[model samples]
Target: MSNHEGTKGNLLAFLPLIVFVVLFIGSGMLTNDFSTMPLNVAILIASAIALLMNRKETFSKKVDVFTKSAGHPNIILMAVIFILAGAFAGVAKGMGAVESTVNLGLSLLPANLLMVGLFVIGCFISISMGTSMGTIVALAPIGVGIAGQTEIPVALAMATIVGGAMFGDNLSMISDTTIAAVRTQHTKMKDKFKVNFLIVLPAALITLVILGVLTRGNAVELAGDYPYDWVKILPYLGVLVAALAGTHVLVVLVGGTIFAGVIGLLDGSYQMSSLLQATAEGIMTMEDLAIVSILIGGIIGIIQYNGGIDYLLRMITRNIKSKKGAEFGIAGLVSAADIATANNTIAIIITGPLAKSIADEYGVDPRKSASLLDTFAGCWQGILPYGAQLLAAAGLAAISPVSIMLYSFYPVLMGICCVIAILIGYPKFKRTDDASASISK
Candidate 1:
């Protein structure tokens, strides 16, 4: 393909994504229920449209792109993580981990601290699980339960969980968003984590303070007599320890599942058949997201092959005149993609290469760009009604995703901090001594 052809994708190249989004909203509207709309079904329909585009290539060539991208090693690895994450959640929660963990935390905290405690718990779980969606699934119900026990609105409680989930989503070394950002930018994971932490810490602190102030002067007391097994909570703790120790994500999740299953069996929480069945059911539940991941990967590959992404980058960055502008450009690109796709890791993968090119072109630091990509993608993903995190949270809480957005303080705060970083350049990095170092314009 000629440079002109490669750099000037037709507007129609985006029809597939546009179609996907329209179908999602349209189905939700027609049914008067957003949660019932399936994203995977939309993707399947959109993929058919995507294949018809980029007609210059042979049919086999297009199929090759779709299949290859879907089966890309990273994509497959991401799928495995989802599987293990689901199994772990299923086995652990089935074995009484979720209830035990919630009880343990709530039983130890004052009423005013409930929201803050939930937020912190979400952060801890998300960091360990490396998935905001998983964290919300595991904790949003507990948040709703908390709301039932206190004067807090259910939406506020759910938002607290979302806020905390985004914290680890942005900072966790094992998170797919973080992994995609670092791998795409060729930056060290630890370096990206450090930069990400520096940028988000203030936002998190402010969120906690806000939670405290919002819930002050209230006391909640539970009337239930439920037992919390410290042993059941061990899987979460073990996952946390292993993740922080830099064990690979798959290892951590698989280990967690095994640990939970063993604990369940030894404690008689599950019969042999039930334990096996629970883990299988848990993994089955993740099919939607896992399939969406693969399909989105292929769709993104097709978009890139057709120069859709290149055209997008050129249009967005055309007027950039400084490093800060480039950073903002990166932020806007990823955030927009996140909103449209409703998935942060996929957004990162779609935008990462272009962000890298923009970073190099404008002398933006790789670590900073990686942080921006991961942070902004996560921020948008956390609050969008149609996004997986909010959808899962809203569904679990039996509330509207829009309602959850009302109190989506953490994501909004994180987004604001990201903008501030772009405007003022916090967490500045030193240039590499090597010749390839990017110096600000």
Candidate 2:
């Protein structure tokens, strides 16, 4: 009864966010271009609504709440990562690393297996880099080029890259999602990774097979000089090695950018001015996303302060009677958070603490709860046509993010696999720490 009563005001607190999503989606539908809606603008207006709704607090105090949330440490870290990712992508392209790397991959795969190879490479690169955006930035352009060369739908190629990126985002030990999930649930990264990998491996294998079969009828062939420059790829290779060796992503990206810039300069592939310009351009490209991220953070913080999320927690878990219900609740919370923020890492961070509480109450394995949060969040990230993975991939490929939805089977399959994991409790493990509900595979 208390939960039922708590939900009443809480539902109203979240209305502003609902309005924002409606306006954004409505404007897109009116324009027939989903990407036409300025997400930051919608957020700003909704933030204003959130302020108006917070009548209990003084306006000044509400503004303070908004400001603190917007500038939170997690948001700041994400902003920094965005800037470096953009710079690395731009400078590497300026240095011919993209072309060289794509050619290298093409050189290794037959025409019919191009999509399969690209998806596999995306998996490896994302796992190594511990970032889906970084992998997408590095690989989507190549996927686009492959589509152009082979007369395939550009959407299919980009979907392959985006799908594989999500895979690693959920499973990579060094990924921010992994770190956030593990820390929040008080589980080890290896434990989460092991459980996560086992749950999602079949989804990946099926995706590979689907891509291979789809591309098998390709009558078109890869074109161009197919130039090979091992030197240009060294920066990417070095970054991969550093990431897999457990180096921080920011350090790996910054070092990789400088390495690519130097190689470009030494090899006469880029002028000093051109390299700087490329870096600047790359940073500029990420401005929209960066700003949107901050606004979402502020809006979410305000909502939470006003009792929106707590309301959700009570409402969603009011009837959770078993471990399965708890798992779904955990997954649902993060998925909702991801949909609201359009960022999986932020989603996990926002829901993780509450998820931990729920896990403890229901005796759900921490490893499984962490995996559920990561997997569900990762799934939504892929399917959200306006989310970072799709938007970034679309921007790089020069295509519509919506088109990729038709071909993005991997994330959908991944989501299904996670649901199956919840139902069957596959890859079962014994709990190690009775206190924290630690699990051993």
TM-score for model 2?
0.86
Give the residue spans of candidate 2 off by over 4 A: 1-9, 186-188, 222-225, 360-363, 398-400, 428-441
Per model, how many backbone clashes are there?
0, 0
Q: Please, what are the lDDT tens digits per residue for candidate 1 over residues 8-121?
A: 655566788888778877777778775566677888988898899876788898889888877878667656656666787779879988788767766788788989888888
How well is each residue in 219-337 modelled by candidate 2, as lDDT tens digits?
46656557879999898788778777777778888998999999999999889899999999987877776776677678777877777766666677777888889999998889877
Q: Provide the lDDT at 423 for model 2.
A: 86
What local distance difference test score does each model get? 0.79, 0.81
Please report the candidate that would top TM-score against the real structure: 2
Pull out the clashing pairs in model 2.
Answer: none
Pairs in clash, predicted candidate 1: none
Worst 10 residues of 2 by lDDT: 1-10
